[model samples]
Target: GFVYAVTTADLYIRGGLANRVLVIGSETFSRILDWSDRSTCVLFGDGAGAMVLEAGEGAGSIADHGVLAASLRSDGAHKDKLFVDGGPSTTGTVGHLRMEGREVFKHAVGMITDVIEATFSAAGITAEDLDWFVPHQANKRIIDASAKKLGIAEQKVVVTVDLHGNTSAASVPLALSVAVADGRIKKGDLVLIEAMGGGFTWGAVLVRW
Candidate 1:
């Protein structure tokens, strides 16, 4: 979600809609979870993240410090695999989060990597070119598999799932904040952010911070 948020903000700036944009991703998954369903409750948490995107000068080179490229993809066909069971109109109450765990894990890695690969191609940079890889904090296995498949080293990946469960929309940005605070992400660093969520939505953004 935050991956696409960055892209949306970047486009807004480029299109002259605004000189600055605040892209925010906040989720309170705990409220919607059914505690009885251990599969869902144990994996999600509340979190918020925001980043400011302001107009900036670019040198028209790889050294440019801004969003370099982005790719977003979604398929409703897989919506049933991971989705809430209720909505205001559908059930008059916020539905509990529901997911086919195996299905989500099966599709997550592939969909995430696809968009990341596309973003990397669009940016004309490979995984090795990234100084930081802040993917959505889904789980360790998915993170490890995606990075391994992309050939991004373990050192370049920023992980915080152990600390912040699955923050849904807040995943990518929350991880970014952690990495930046710890000095892993710095100015002019080529950072790649990626995310996949319950709507079967996924995206990737390559930004030079």
Candidate 2:
């Protein structure tokens, strides 16, 4: 999938695959030393995106298909929790990614669990069946809470937020590449991907190697 949007990090990226509803989080604002009175650059920097999901089977069971099932959800009430103020009409520009970090973090944890649960229920699976549980790598604490809520094994989660610093949609696939290179996500393994972002959009995807 290819899209045009002013990234919170001010990056211009186009085109990529959406494997299930992989969750990739962006926390670009955390790097800002000052969260107040920076008219030049508001709380922009953090943003995230997920892959465009497509279904395919290869003589695979829930453990064989590239993606078995997925779910998505969002709430408008939290719209202001995180957002950019500028737009094409206002400044003839893409605004910065401003947000209430604490608030969004709170909502993220709860919503993430909901999305994963929905995926599991729809797929008729359980946490025990998951080989890898990757969440939007926005905050370590958030990742911990969501995984814990879903009863996912600690060993099954892969974290790339530290190195990538939340490339938004790029996070999930980037980490997948890492695990693939490291020989962690072997063929036929069940992988779960999830993420939450600006529009309060969030979802999960279940895939098999």
Candidate 3:
């Protein structure tokens, strides 16, 4: 959802549909979780994060303010790998989250890094050019694997999973906020953001901060 939010805002700005857009990613996984299920219950927490994007004039280079490039992708084939067991229309009740953790982890790093590379290609930049890589706060292992695969330095990745748990949609933005607040991300910095979610949905966004 964080990737979806940022991509949608970027598209709107590029399409002349809007000048400034507010994108938010929030989730309350606790409400739907089966507390008895430790696997899913203990891994998530409720949280929200937001950002406002405004139009800016640039020289059509990588130095452009706001979003420079983005890539969004989804695969329904892996939908059952991580999902809830019930839905309002299907089961008439909100259901507990269920997941095949090992299976999802196996595909996550590759899926995430693929989109990040695509975004870098689209922006005419590389991981070496990034000042920060803020990925979804799903877990330390996934975050570490993705960064390592992309060759993005450990110092460049913004991680907040330890402090916030897996806030689902809120992960990226929350991590970004932390990086920015602590001075790791700053003016003119090139930042890369990415996420992979339950529907097997995933995407990446490149921005000049």
Candidate 4:
């Protein structure tokens, strides 16, 4: 979700459609959750995030201080593994969130690494070249496993799930904000933002900030 926003903003900025774009991702999972269902309800949190992307001039190289590359993918075959049970048109109700937690974790790691690798390849760099990796704050096991598989060091990964349970669409931007506010992410640093969510959606966006 965050990757899609960033990439879309990049397109508008580069295409001369807009000088700046305010991309915001806000979610209120608590409202849609069934509080009685501890399994899925407790795993979510309410949060919102906003980012402003403006036009910038660069040398047209990998060193550009903006969105460099992005890779997005979605597979509905596994949609039932992670999704809400109701919707307005389908069920005439906003249903509770439902998921097969174990099944999601199994696919999350593989799907995440696949798209991230594609982004890295498109930008002609590897995990070692990234200054920081801010991934979806969904699960610690999945986050750690994905990084380990991609060869990204532990210290370079920005984590906040321990602090903020999963914020859905707000995960990446929230983590990015935390890292930035703490002085971890800084100017000219190569950062990679990745996320996986309901609908079996996943994506990776590389930026030089």
Candidate 5:
């Protein structure tokens, strides 16, 4: 949702459909999590985050104060790897979240880094050019692995999982908010955001603050 929100807003602005958009990502994971299932429940929390994007002028370069490039992708074949067990259409009930943690971790880094690379390529920049890498707060392992694989410096990664847990779609924006509030992200800085969610949906967005 966070990826889609930002991408959609960027498209609208570029397409001359709108000058500004309020993109929000929120989740109530606690409501659907099985409290007894420590593996899933204990790894998640409830949260919300938002970003307001408006058209702005730049020097017609990567330093533009708006979204520069984005890449969104999904694979249904891997959907069962991480998902809720029930839904209204299937069981007439909101289901508890279920996941194969090991399987998810195995593929997460590759999937996330792939889109991020594509985004960087589209923006004509590399990991070294990024001021911050705000990835989904899924876990330390995934975040570390992805950053390491991309060669992004440890100091440039914005992590908030330890402070807020995995808030699903809300992770990226929450981390962004935290980083901005703490002065880690600043005006004119190049920021890269990425996330992989249920249904095997994932994406990346590159922006200049």
Candidate 6:
């Protein structure tokens, strides 16, 4: 699945879904930053990375399968509040990401949590049974709150926002690669990946790697 701003002039694009979704949360804020504007620039960076997840055999529950469950959600009402101003017809130009940070923050927390819980229920797993919880690397505050609400330890979560900022579609897989390469994620371990983007689009992928 892909996450982008449909409310803005930017055209959305996505590719076919393969057998597996490694899941990631990468950002490239620096590449799109107005460096002079510290409020936004200071919150970004640029990079790309990816993860690898193959099909596995399991009984039925999350404990039985590679990716036993996941959830997706959206809300169109707040579209304009956190989107770019220009589009092909309006200004014949692509506008930068304009957001009411705090506003987006509120929706993000609730949505992320909602998806996570749904994923667990669908998979027949409990939050306590999760080995890792990975969320979009949007902000530290949102990350911390989601973890707390889910009763997950802060150390069990993966974060790349400070370095990658908000690489959009690239974030999740990139962080997964980091964890695996660093020996943090191991084979047969359970990982829950979730994200919320401008479309108000969000989803969760629970997998075993």
TM-scores for all candidates: the values are 0.95, 0.73, 0.95, 0.95, 0.95, 0.79
- What is the alpha-carbon lDDT for the whole of candidate 6? 0.67
Q: With candidate 5 superimposed using the best TM-score fit, by how many Å does residue 164's alpha carbon deviate from the native? A: 0.8
TM-score of 5: 0.95
Least lDDT summed over 10 consecutive residues: which range in candidate 3?
A: 85-94
lDDT of each: 0.89, 0.66, 0.89, 0.91, 0.90, 0.67
The predicted structure with the larger lDDT, 2 or 3, is 3
Colliding pairs, model 3: none
User: lDDT for model 1, on a 0 to 1 scale?
Assistant: 0.89
TM-score of 4: 0.95
Candidate 1 clashing pairs, residues 3+ apart or interchain: 188-209
- List candidate 3 stretches off by more than 4 Å: 88-94
Model 6 lDDT tens row, 35-133 = 565666666556566544444445655456454555777778888756655643443345566667778887887888888888888878788888887
RMSD in angstroms, candidate 2? 7.4
Preferred candidate (TM-score higher): 1 or 5: 1
Query: Model 5, residue 103: what's the lDDT?
Result: 92
Name the candidate, 4 or 6, with the larger lDDT value.
Answer: 4
Task: Kindly report which residue stretches of model 1 are placed more than 4 angstroms away from their true locations once superposed.
Answer: 88-94
Candidate ranking (lDDT, best to worst)? 4, 5, 3, 1, 6, 2
Shift of residue 200 alpha carbon in model 5, Å: 0.4
If candidate 5 were superposed on the true structure by all CA atoms, what would the RMSD be? Answer: 1.9
Better candidate by TM-score, 5 or 6: 5
lDDT of 2 by residue, 1-209 (tens): 01111121112111223323433333455443234446424323344444333334355446455556767776788888866666435433344556778888878888889888988998899999888987766677899888898898889999977776655655666677778789998877898878788778888878776
lDDT of 4 by residue, 101-209 (tens): 9999888899999999999999999999999999999999999999999999999999999887999899888999999999999999999999888898889999999
